[model samples]
Target chain A: MGNLLRFEWRKLWQQKSLYICFGIGLAINFLALLSAKNFGALDSALGNMCVALNSGYTSFLGIYIALYACQDSSQQTIKNIYARGYSRSLVYWVKYAVSLGVTLATALLYWGFNFLLTCCFGGEVGSFITAVGQALALQLWVIIGYHGLFFGVAMLLNKLGGSIAINLIGVDCVFVVLSLIISLLKIDFNVMYYNLPNLLTDIVEASLMMPEFTSSMVLRGIIIPVLYVVTFVGAGWLVNRRRDV
Target chain B: MNENRQTNYVITTDNLTKVYGKKTVLDHVSMHVAQGDIYGFIGKNGAGKTTLMKLLLGMSQPTEGKIELFGSHQLNLGRAKIGALIEAPAFYQNCTAYENLQRFAILANAKGQDLHALLDFVGLGNVGKKKAGQFSLGMKQRLGIAIAMLGNPELLVLDEPINGLDPEGIKEIRDLLLRLNREQGVTILVSSHLLDELAKITTRYGIINNGRLVEETTATELMQNCQHKLQVLTDQPKQAEKIIKKMYPQVPLLVSESGVEVIAEDIDSGAINRALVLDGVNVRGLTAITDNMEDYFIQRMGGNNG
Candidate 1:
């Protein structure tokens, strides 16, 4: 299993698509920061940077995971891993771990660059140090949920273009429909606010815009995405184990 | 039972079958690949050669029956001892030949093997920085062999390794396989439609037709079964056959429209010509038509599927 992980890690790192995805992530954050610096919103630059990073990574991570992690299935390169005597479950986990690591690294590049920009151009760090920490932590958890969701969709669809389309279109439609229903009803459904997209929006607000953080809000933010990770990744693992490839 | 099975055969399958929907691809295929033997698996397209190879490698599960590899009923455990390149060469297209092998070597736990030496063995030593996607079909096939030979496995199962190679590439692979078998005594079960090329290196042949193991025989046995007949085209074939049969009643002779086919190992054509001419049977032409591996396959499979 150790060797397989190392093998997958090396293979994953060598892909040109992975580097391209990471570059895109960095560019989106850079452009957002450039805009904030130009507009002279120096006091609120940190909050804008955090929201931009969160939104950019959340949208792109799914496509990145779909193209890079799901590539082996279309190329049939995963057969070599299994041909080396590793079980299907072990192969799936290796891919899962390596893909998760890659998505995290891309996320860090986006957030890390924003951190430097915030320190250089924005207000003093001592004022918003705790907020920055909370935003970074919440973004990390949110990215895990994206990784799991995209990874599971990739395995289930097992095609690059198809996985990307489903993740982008399918996930957006669900969130949009749910939000519309909640707005129309004008009901006080506290659980609806803790859904994935809304939960991520709440996390960003709590971290930067909002002054106080409720215990329930923080707890829901962590627990909900964690459950998303378990459900989607578990489903993918089950399908991959029985798949003939 | 395990001891007896392990001492000889490296691969044994009993009544292996695979079905997809209503179509049965393989039906009751009981195959045996002996230790140290270069077993040539001959079949037409869609003859279940790849299906059987997949089952043996555990790439696909069998609908019915058992497969024992390396003397163990546990195929997954025994797969570590086997090296295979089924269907096409499955490798990361973006990775170079050396990079691909290094990655697989780590996964295969074959770090002890020299990476450069294996590349050079397959004639891909100087292919530095050239990604596998850019490689020609022949080069990809050679790299596939290098990858398979990485762990120094005792058994090799390759499917159509020589499918799209030039004459030079074919000879190079043939020599490499021959050397591997002779020097290292590694057992090979290769499936190829190129019978003549496969015949040059195979010790034993397994002919599969319509998902059935039609025949399994050694080279010597196949040689004996090949068409070895002396044709004597004469004006009076009937008279010539009578005279030849009268002299040698033990030799099997078939009289045809054009000539008489004498099925014998040692026959003096000069003596037969002299005797036929003396008997007023005008001998126009006489030639020997011998059957090779290709002929034997055609005869066994009941003609070309084409």
Candidate 2:
């Protein structure tokens, strides 16, 4: 299992797409910082940058997972792992762990750089630090949700255009469309508000408002996203384990 | 268990069948490859060679029957002791040949193996910092061999490893396979359309047609069993045929449009000529014909399907 993870890490790290995704995240954060400096908006910039990073990090992570899964399936590189006496479930879990690992690493580096830059550029840091901490904690669950959901879709679809398109369009839009249809029809599906993507945005907004981090709030953050992660990952694992490479 | 162990067979499939929906791709293929034997698998395109290889590699499950590798029917444990390159070698296209092998070596838990030496053995030692995507088809093939040789596996199962090589590339790969078999005693099961190269290297051969293993024979047995006949073209061919039969009733003679073809254990042109002249039959042309591997394959496969 350790060797499998190491091999996956090497393959993922060697892709030029990794650098492109990281570069895009950095460039977006840099542009946000420059605008905040120009407009004298440093006081609110940190919270706003967190929101942007939250979306940027999750979307980029999804794209990376989709691309990696597509390449592995299309080129049949997963055979390398399986042919070496490794089981299919182990390979699936390794991919899941690696995706989450790389995503967390990228997010932390981006957030740390932005936070340090905001402090250097005279941004307000009082109490916002605590809020960002709570938000980061909540974001971990949301990140897992996004990775599991996207990785599952990639494994299920097992193609370049379909996986990426579903990750970018299907996952992002299907929930919105369903929610809008519910609203239009006057349906009372309150749980829709607790979906991981929707809850992520709400959590980031609450962090901006500097709300109290209650135990109920923490439970809500962890439970909903964990459910999403488990449901998607469980379905993907069952299907992929039986699939012939 | 003792019987399987004493047989010395490296791979044996019993009634292995693969069916895709309504189409049966491989039907009851029972094949055997012995240890220290270079076995050649010959078939036409879509004749289930790749499918069988996939089954052997455990990439797919068989619909029926069993496959035994290294005396074990349990695929996972047996597969660890085998190296394979099926259809084509798959690697990270963005990675260089050395890096790709390094990653595979790491995956195979061959940490102490010298990857550079394997690269040199496959004639790709000078390829540095070049991504596998940029490699020509032949170079990619050699790289595939290098990758399969990682971990120093005892058994190799390669499918069409010489598909796109030039003459020189073909010879290099042939020599490499020969050296591996001769020096390290690695048992090999290779499938290819290049029958000439396969003929030179393989000690055993399996011919599959329409998803069934039609024939399996050792090189020596095939050579000994291949049809050897004497051709005689003569004036008054019917008369010569009657005379030869009267003199030598033991010889099996086949009469054709222009002459008589004789199938006998011991054929003597001088004795036959004198016997024919004694009967006033003119012998115009006399020649002996022996069938090689290619001819035997054509004959077994019912001509030209290969």
TM-score of chain A of each: 0.87, 0.90
Tens-place lDDT per residue, model 2, A1-245, is 88889988988888778789888877877777878788987655457546655546666777788888678778777776677767788888898888789877887787777777777788765455676778877887777787888888888888888888888778657777888888899988964666666778877877877655667777888888787788888888988877877
**What is the clash count for each candidate, in the order shown?**
0, 0
- Evaluate model 1: give its lDDT: 0.81
Per-residue alpha-carbon lDDT of model 1 for A6-93, expressed as tens digits?
Answer: 8878877777777776678678777777776788665354565467556567667777778776777777767666666778787788
Screening candidate 1 with a backbone cut-off below 3 angstroms (N, C-alpha, C), the clashing residue pairs are none
The lDDT per prediction is 0.81, 0.82
Interface alpha-carbon RMSD, every candidate: 1.4, 1.4
Which parts of model 1 are misplaced by more than 4 Å? A43-53, A126-138, A177-195, A209-219, B1-6, B243-253, B263-288
Name every residue pair that clashes in candidate 2. none
lDDT of 2 by residue, B52-114 (tens): 988888788789989888887677777777788887788778789998898899877788999
- Model 2: residue A30 alpha-carbon error in angstroms: 2.6
Q: TM-score of the candidate numbered 1? A: 0.88
Instruction: Give the lowest summed-lDDT range of ten residues in model 1 chain B.
Output: B1-10
Q: How many backbone clashes does candidate 1 have?
A: 0
